[model samples]
Target: KKRGVQTGLIRTLESALVWVFEQFPGTEAALNDLLTQESGPESLLIGKGSEAEMARALG
Candidate 1:
């Protein structure tokens, strides 16, 4: 069960990355900027609860 949860998390993260790349063109630079500014993985994970914040962050 733990392994399954880990696999699911990986898949979800992969999908989130794809979505970000597709939704926001030229995000590579923005991503670099965001990374240089923050220290946590929370900035990368786009959960349903954080949809609005994610949009704002990407913007």
Candidate 2:
């Protein structure tokens, strides 16, 4: 990063968004709104869906 800000990989979703809120307070509302507006049902489906073969195929 140009500013040397640390970056991380999002390997899993569990607690990841909560960690983001911890790192950047007061962003919860805006972030939630953005994700809601941007994500289609399929995207959210995959995110919350099982990782089994059938689930991935559905996504």
Candidate 3:
């Protein structure tokens, strides 16, 4: 949603995440870590023209 790509189906996404966590148990922890590692909410002010923001967001 942040990058403005069109997407939907929340239940399917949730099921896919469950499948991923089941298939690779370690993946859930890494994803949890990413979710928890928050410095600030710079995403609210980001502009699409800058690739650096995208790179940082991905990292």
Query: Would you list the C-alpha lDDT of every candidate in the order shown?
Result: 0.68, 0.54, 0.60
Q: Compose the digit string of candidate 3's lDDT tens values, residues 1-59.
A: 26753477777889998997888757777655545657333433455337755444444
Measured with C-alpha atoms, the lDDT of residue 11 in candidate 3 is 72
Best by TM-score: 3
Runs with alpha carbons beyond 4 Å of true place in candidate 2: 1-11, 35-59
Ranking by TM-score: 3, 1, 2
Task: Residues 1-59, candidate 2: write the lDDT tens digits.
Answer: 27653355444454786786777665576545534665644564565655664233432
Number of backbone collisions per candidate: 0, 0, 0
lDDT of 3 at 40: 34
Q: What is candidate 1's lDDT per residue for 1-59, written digit by digit as tens? A: 24346547888998998887888797766666766765555646545346667556656
User: In model 2, how large is the Cα lDDT of residue 58?
Assistant: 30
Give the runs in model 3 whose Cα sits over 4 Å from its true position: 1-8, 40-59
TM-score, candidate number 2? 0.34
- Give the per-residue Cα lDDT of candidate 3 at 3: 72
- In terms of lDDT, which candidate is strongest? 1
